[model samples]
Target: MNRKDKIALERYRKRLEFARSSGEVNAFETKAEQKARIERAKKDYAYMCKEYFPHYATSEPADCHLKAAKQTMKNPTIKKFDEMPRGFGKSVMDDILIPFWLWINDQAHYMVLVTVSKDRASELLEDLRAEFEGNPKIIHDFGEQHGHGQWEKGFFITKSGFVAKALGAGQSVRGLRVKSRRPDYIVVDDLETKELIKNPKRQDEYVKWIERDLIPTMDGDIRRFVYANNRFAPVMIQTKLQEKHPEWVVNHIKAYDPVTYKPTWHQKYHDNYYRELEKDIGTLALEAEYLQNPQVEGYYFKPEHIQYGKMPKLNQFKIIIGTWDVAYAGSATSDYNAIDVKGLHDKNFWVIDTFVKRCKMVTAVSYMCDFQKRLPKTVVVHWRFEAQFWNDEVERVIRETERQYGIKLNILKIQVPKIKKMDRILTLHPYYQNGRIFYNEKLKSHNDTQVGIAQLLSIEPNYKTNDDYPDTQQTGIALLEPYNTQNDGLNYRQGKMRPKNERI
Candidate 1:
C-alpha cells in the first residue's frame, strides 16, 4: 500500500523479466555447445576415474563393448544401448552411463528410470542411490537429496542446469507426469518378462500402454528408450517396434565368438538340455523351449493349417445332414458329443452348422426340432444318431418331433466299431491331409478340432487332451468315407441303409 513497497515490488518484477529474456542468465547452451561440453566432460571424468579407481576401471579394458557403451553415452544421437545377456556389464552400464551423463551435462533436465517389476525397479533405484552417495565426484557434479522408496528424488544443480529422478515401471509410474520438468532422458532397463512377452494380447496391451502413457510425457527431442532383456518371442517390444517403426535405430548386443560369430555358449547349453529333454519329450519340445520356435503340442489340432475349400454357395449345397456325438446324465466320465451338420455338394462338403450338447436326450431332440424350423424347405436335413446306448431315446424324440411338426425326419443308425485310439486317428488322417475336409471359421470347436487332427497325424500316438469328441469326430469321418471321392457319383450301397450295432 505504501509507495516505497510498490517501487521495490516493481523493481523485483523488472529484474525477473530481464532474467527470463536474457538466455545467457543460465549456462544452458545450444546443441553444438552442449556436444562440445559433453566431450570435454567425458575426457575429464574418464581421467578422474583412472586416477581414483585405477583397478576397478581397467578390469575389462580389453572388452570393446564396455568401451563402446562409454563412448555411446557421450554422443547425443545415441540415446539407448540394448545390452543383451547376463554378466555383460548391463548393471554397470546402468550405474555408470546414465548418472555420469547427467552429472557431466548440467543442462539435462529429468531422467525417468524403469524396470520390468516393482521389486527390480526398487532395487535399481537403490543401486543408483549407492553409486551417487559413494562417489564424492558424482555428489560434487550432482547435488544430493535423500528420501524413501517412491518419495525418493534427487537433482544435479550443474553450472548449466540439469536434474535426474529415479522411478519404476508400474501403475505407480503414472505419477511421472506430475513433475514440473519434462524428461530430457529416459532409461528403461529390462522392462519385459518371459510370460508377458510371449503372450500376444499381453504384449499388445503393454506396447500400447508404453506408447500412449509413457512416451508422450517425455521431451521427444532428447528422449531415450533404453531396454535390455533375454530374447522372448517375435511379439516382444523390441521385435515389434523394429517391425512397425523401421526408422528407429535398434541394435542387438549378443554374446558370440569374435571370429566365427557363432552362439557357442548358447548352443552348448541348448545341446546339453536337449539331449535329456528329447529322451523324455520330443524334438518339438526342444525346438519350442530352447530355440524359441512355435510348437504344436497338446493342441487338439493345428487350426492355422486348416484349408478353406472353394465350393458352391450355401443355397446350392441344400442337402444338409446332422450327426450327433451324444452324451447324457451329466456323468463326469461322459463325452460331451457334437452334432456336426454338413451340406452335401456335387464335389465338396460344406460344414454349414453344428450343435454340441451334453444333456438329456429329450433336450437334444427339442434343440434339433427348433433348428429344423429355421432351415430351407428344399434342404433335406437328415439326422444320424450313433446307434449305441442312447439310440432308442434319440429315436423316440425324433418320432415325436416329426409327428408334431409334420416334417418327415429321416433318422439313420450307424454302427461305430470299437477300435484302438491310434487306429481311429490313422483312419481320419488321409481325409484331412488330402484336403477333403473343411470346417466353418466361426466354429467354437475350431481349436479343439485342429488339435485332434494333429494328434491323429503325428507319427507317434500322443493323445494328451480329452479324446471323446475328437474320437467321435474320427468315427463320423469314417462313416462318411464311402461318400468321399473325386467323382460326383454317390455310392448307392454306402448311402442305401445305415449300419446296425454302432458300438465305440
Candidate 2:
C-alpha cells in the first residue's frame, strides 16, 4: 500500500480504539432509540445545549439571547450579528454548541468557523474535536460515532455527514467544498483585534472581505451567517454588519445596564466586580469590553489633538477668564465644582490652571474665592455658571464671597441654553480637533485633567457621569465666542472683550 493510505488506515484504527476505551460504544441501546432521543433534543436548542454542555447550564435569563440567536441561524437566508459583551458565552455558543446543534439536526451540510488568527481558529477546532470525540455527555447519547477518517485539527467531519472547517480572518475560504457540497453556514467569532480596529485602512479592508468575499462563500440560497464579537472598537465587523443590513436581527447584549450599572448576570459578575475591572483597565477599555461601546481615541477628544507644552505666562495673554460649572446638589456623590482658568491671545487659547473640588455650596464658593485671590491681580478673571437650577443661591454665594474676600468679582450668570448637553459639548470638538486648545502640563498633576480627558473621549449622548468635566471645558471654550469672527453680533468688542464692570 502507498504511504498515504497506510497513514490513513493507522489513524482510523487509533480513533476506533480510543472510542472503545472511553466507553463511547453503546452496547445496550438500539439505533432507533438513540436517533429518537437526538431528534427530540433537536426540537429545543437550549435543551440540546444543556444536555451536552451541562457545566455551562445557568438559570440566568440572558441565556435566552443565545437560544434566540441559534434560532436566527437555523434559517438558510437570514444573516445575523450577535454583538454581546465579554463573558456572555458568545464564542462558546457559536464555536461549539451551535455548530453541534446544526450537525445533529441535519440543518447544515457544511460550516466554517473563522477567528482573528489561524492559530486561534485551529484551537477552536481542537476544542470541537474534544467534545465530539471525548465528551461523555455527547458520547453517551450518540454512542461511538464520528466520521472514520475525516477528523483532524482545523478540519473535521461527523458521522452524520456534517463537514466543518476552521479558517482565520482573510484566509482563502473560496472553493471550500466538502463531500461535493458548498458551505451552507458560516460562523465568525472574535474576528477583530486591537491592532485591526486601530487603523481605519485595515478596518476598511476587513469590511471588504466580509462584503466581497466571505458572505458569497455560502452555497445555497437559504444559507446562514452568524457573526459574534465583543465590540473592542466602535468600528468593528459587527458594527459594519449592522450598518450594512439594518433589517438583520441584531442582539446587542451588554454585560450590565448603562444606568443602574447592574450586571446582566448578578451571580457571576456584580457591579463591584466590574468596578474593579474598570479601575484596572481604565474607563475606555472597560467601556469597550464590558459595555460593548468602544470609545475610539480621537473620535471625540484625542491626546494628540490638543497641543501640549509649557504653559504660557499668565500675563502674556490679552485676557484671562474662568468658567464655572457648579454642582447644585452639594452632596458627597454629586458632581465636583470645576473652575477652568483660560487665557486668550490673538487666536490661541491656553488653559492656565484649574480649580476642581467636591464640596458643599459654601465651601465651593470659598474655594473659588481662594483660586481668584491666588491669580495675578492684573489678569482679569470672568466667571460664568449655569444658573437655571439654583440661581438665587449661587448669586448669594457670589455676594458673600466678594464681601468676605474684599475683592470685586466679574461674574456672568448664563441662563443654561435649552439644548442637549452633548450638542454643546460637540461645539468644542472642533477646537480640540484643530489644535487650537493648549493645556498646561501642570494640569495633569495639579488637577484631574487626565481623568477629565478620558471622560471627554468616552462621553456619549446617553453617558451619565462624564458631562461635568467636558461641560466646564466647553464653557471655557465658549468664553472665546466674543472674539470669534463668525459671531458677528457677539464680536462687537473685537480683540479682548472685557468683563462687565460690576461688583457682585
Candidate 3:
C-alpha cells in the first residue's frame, strides 16, 4: 500500500478499537459515525507524536554531518558521533538529531539533551522549535499546532511515544527521569566549568551524578553524546564513562580542527595571535591559555627572592625559636602538618629547614629528635609546638620524646585568632618583600605548596583547600613578626665570638 493508504488504514483500526472500548458503537453503527471515529483517531495519534517527538520535525539525517556518520543501526543499541567546532551547527545537533530519528521511525524513544547551564538547554530547545515551525514538510506531515509550553516548549504525541526533555549541569539535571522503558539518547554538552574542571570535589560530584542518576536510565539501546572543551580535570564525567564503558564509541574534536579533518583557517589565525602574544606578554600567559600548560611555579613569589646565601659563623643574634604545626595523623583524607624552624642569624630571621610529614605522633616525635641532633649545640633554643589540635596521647608522646632526648620543648597553648585562610598567607607577604624572611631550597618539594600559597594570596577570601603547609608557614611568620620589634634594642650576644682583630 502507498504511504497515504497505510496511514488511513492505521487510523481506521485505531478508531474501531477506541469505539469498541468506549461502548459507543454497536454492530449496526451508521456510516457517518464510523467516519467520524476514524478522523478522531487520526487526530489523536498526530497530537501524541507532536507533543513527545517534536524533534522529529526539526531533526533530519541530512541536516547534521555528525548524525549522517552514525545513521546505520546494526544493534540500534549504541549511537555515537563527534563534531568539531563550527558555527552554530553544534546547537542544531543538540536541538534536532534524536527527535527527527524517532519521528521517522515512529518508535517509543526517550531523549535527554544536557549542557553546562539551564539557559543553554532552553536555548537549544527554542532553536529546535523555530526549525520545526519554519519547516513546511514537518507542518504538512505532523500538523502545525502540535507543540506546547510557553516557557519550556516540547512536542508531544499520544501514541507514537514521548520526547522527555533537556537539562543542564547541577541538581536540575540529576532529577530528570522518564517512566518509559529506556532513554533513546542522552546528550551531555560542555557540562564542566573552568573552576569545576580544576576542582577535585566538583569533578567527583559530576561523576557521581552520572553513575547514580545517568547510567541507571540507559537500556540495551542507548545513544549518548558528549561534547565539551578539553579542560584538565583529574576525572571528568566524560573521561570516567569512557573508561567504564569501553564499547562506547568516543569522538574528540579540538577547537582548531576543520570540519573536513584538516586544520581550519581559524586555527591558523589563533596560531598567529598566540605567536604575537608570546612575543608581547612573554611565555607564561601564552602557555597557560593557548597550549593549556601549567603556569610556572614561583612566578608570583620566587623562592630566590627570599634566600639568604650564607650567614656569619658567629652568633650575633639573641633569640632563637623553632615552631611546629603538628598533625594528628597521616591519611589519604587529610593533609600532613608542616613545621618550620626559624632563628635569628646575623640579625636576620632565617627559616633554615622545614619538616613535613603525614605520620603518627610517635613517628613525628622521632623525626624531630633526629632533626635536633643536627642543630648547633649553642644556638639551639626553645622548640615551640602548636598544641591546639594535638590530642592528649600525642602530647604525652611528644613530652616523653623530648625528656628522653634531653631537649627543651615549649608547647604553646595560644589560640590563633580566626581569620580567612588566604588572608593568613598574605600576612607573610610584607616580610617576604622586605627581605626579613628567607626559605630554604627544600620548600619547593612539598606538593602544591607554592600553588596553595599563591592561591591563598590571590584567591577570594572564601576559597578553601587542603592547604595545611601554607597555613603552618603563615603561623610561624605571624609569631616571628613581633620578634623584629622586641629584639630591636637588645645587645647582640656574640657567642663563640670571632676575634675582630683576627681579620686585621
Q: Compared with the true structure, what per-residue lDDT tens digits does model 1 show for residues 128-177? A: 44444344434433344323323332323222334445554544445564
- Error (Å) of candidate 2 at residue 272 is 2.2
Residue 412 lDDT in candidate 3: 61
> What lDDT is reached at residue 414 by model 1?
75
> For residues 181-238, could you state the per-residue lDDT of candidate 2 as single tens digits?
8887788888887777767777777778877888788866658888987766656767
Off by over 4 Å in 2: 1-40, 56-64, 67-70, 198-202, 299-301, 304-413, 416-452, 455-469, 477-504
Query: Taking the tens digit of each residue's C-alpha lDDT, what string does model 3 give over 422-494?
Result: 6666666555665666554555443333433433333333443345556776776666555664434542222
TM-score of 1: 0.41
Q: Which ranking of candidates, highest lDDT first? A: 2, 1, 3
lDDT of each: 0.51, 0.69, 0.50
- Of the two candidates 2 and 3, the one with more favorable TM-score, higher being better, is 2
Q: Whole-model lDDT, candidate 3?
A: 0.50
Worst 10 residues of 3 by lDDT: 256-265
For model 3 the TM-score comes to 0.40
